[model samples]
Target: MSLAQRWREARPPVAGVHLDSGACSRQSLAAIDAAVQHARHEGEVGAYVAAEAAAPALDAGRAAVGALTGLAGSDVVFTTGANHALDLLLTAWPGERTIACLPGEFGPNLAIMAGNGFAVRPLPVDDAGRLDVEGAARSLAADRPALVHLTPLASHRGLVQPLAAMSEVCADLDLPLVVDAAQALGHMDCATAPAAIFGASRKWIAGPRGVGFLAVRPDLAQRLQPRLPPPQWPTALSVLQRLEHGEANIAARLGFSVALGEHLAAGPALVRERLAEVGRMTRTAVADLPGWRVVEPVDEPSAITTLVPTGGADPETVRKRLIADHGIVTTYAGVERAPFEMTSPVLRVTPHVDATDEDVARFVDALAAVSA
Candidate 1:
């Protein structure tokens, strides 16, 4: 069966609403199914698919990500996840290096750098969640950072960072800009400039879990060392290495290609426009709801929506209520802040290409009921 047909067959029946693509995208089920099928067929199933196939489905998946991200096929490397990609990328980063990130950047990245012994610095962001480019440049200059990390769209806040501008700053400083495009990939046009772009298949591209790619500029690839080398060191890099070498994701790669093909058949411009329309509708519906404020900008490139509840409602409490009482699924962002709790508690909602207008309405209505 075709990827879409496979998707239709495999997708689970779920209830009221869904809005947590940052954690995972329901859209990726088709690609995952395809990957699983191909993996099973090749006897390349399990973690060592990297070693079994000369050109594994996982490699194909990495290549597909490179195509989507505007990188050369050879520039892409597969990782366990976006977080694994981040850790691998920063593993060898020079010492005392300052990495600039948005205040509301994904929390795990900060923890990774801290654990790895890099100094982390927060850049200023406007209310809409765009990074202050000038400020970022100044910080980079002051710190003489060895590497700079950014999330094109802040997963927690649903904000789109100005990638081209940030790329320019990194270019000026001769620094490598590592973009966490986990949320931006499929939803936005990628920059063609040289940089390290990491993304997960589980989010916007709607692929499978345990799959992600890191695209390094062709020139940079030679300079960086592989975090995990294949068993046959000099002979050839494993499937992961071949992925780093630019092998395509056979099954999911085909599925991702199919997904992008569908997006193109629908027209990426049209897909983006539809997402924006749904986002606007969701924002409008939530505007009048009591004690709920939309934190992310309405015009951001991503389809994620972040809501902050007023009136002392705990985010976890509301999230559980939405799931249990209303059949609506959502995500909470305040779980990590223990010592000094973050004042702005956020709940995320994500809309996919497959999501319907009725889905949006049902989700909003669920939110209204939960808030009430």
Candidate 2:
């Protein structure tokens, strides 16, 4: 079967054309079943026993995450979600109270850095809001921030950052690079070995919510001293596991593992290629809409496409009407999503690999009808 066919068959029936995979993807049957089965097993044989029984699947999932990010299973740490993962990393950051990041970094991440007592500086970027590698390298060398953070794919725009180039720069400068791959893990290639990488299971991975992971370099892991919550354990775990809390939803981790397996079996390269094609198709199809302009280029590498509404059309109202009147789902990104760079609100359309030409047509027609 084609990849789309397999994906469609694996997922439950959708209420409408789902174009908001950037927020939360539709979960597959395998993932849902794994989570539900684990919950049931917990009821049958106590939660701790069930978790012990689930160790192998969980370990396999960790190893898969490590492989994706160019780390080992032992180096992967689980958390509530990407927010928690970042909190763990920033709390354990073994550096000074300053960091540099892209201007288009996610707004919540900025809040997290501030909450952790780190002063933020914007890295140099081109006019298009992408990392200017040479400029960024020069700025990093001159300023010498304690660390560098990158969001490879911004939530409000489709621009893909030059993570590999930045990684090389950090390696040369011996500056630690922390990556927020919440939107990049399944949608794009994430094997770049930075100092630390973190992401969630709910977005492109199509895994259950409430699961996130952090993979740290071995030497960096040793240096990070995560401020563990009250009631710490006496025995020792792996250095990475120290970041994870003792209590967790084991069932969700199993579901995440199943989703990771499903993504791997479908092949990451194939998935990324199909998503890029869908993105290009969506951008082309929506290019001529009245009073709305595509934010990204016709062939942006990522799957996300943002539209800036013109002529006094409120994107938030349009987003609501798309769901209420047309039964189409999408995201309305306000300046709050990327406060530093976004000048206006935008409509975000992010379809998954299972999206069809008909789906794109439906969205275009629905948008036209609602905006008029």
Against the hidden reference, what TM-scores do the models get?
A: 0.82, 0.97
Query: lDDT scores for all predictions?
Result: 0.66, 0.90
Among these predictions, the greatest lDDT belongs to 2
Compared with the true structure, model 1 gives a TM-score of: 0.82
Over the stretch 1-372, how does candidate 1's per-residue lDDT look in tens digits?
Answer: 433344334456544566666677674455556666666766755534633553554455555566666786667766656887778767744345577777766777778878878876677766555788998888778777667887777666666668888888889889878888877776766654547888777776666666676787866655555544543466555433643443335555445544544444445565566566656666766776787888755665567777888866777888999889877777888745211224566787776655666777787777777776
> Which regions of candidate 1 are displaced past 4 Å?
1-15, 28-32, 42-60, 94-96, 127-129, 227-267, 335-342
Candidate 1, residue 219: how far the Cα is off, in Å? 2.3
Best by TM-score: 2
Looking at model 1, how many pairs of residues clash? 9
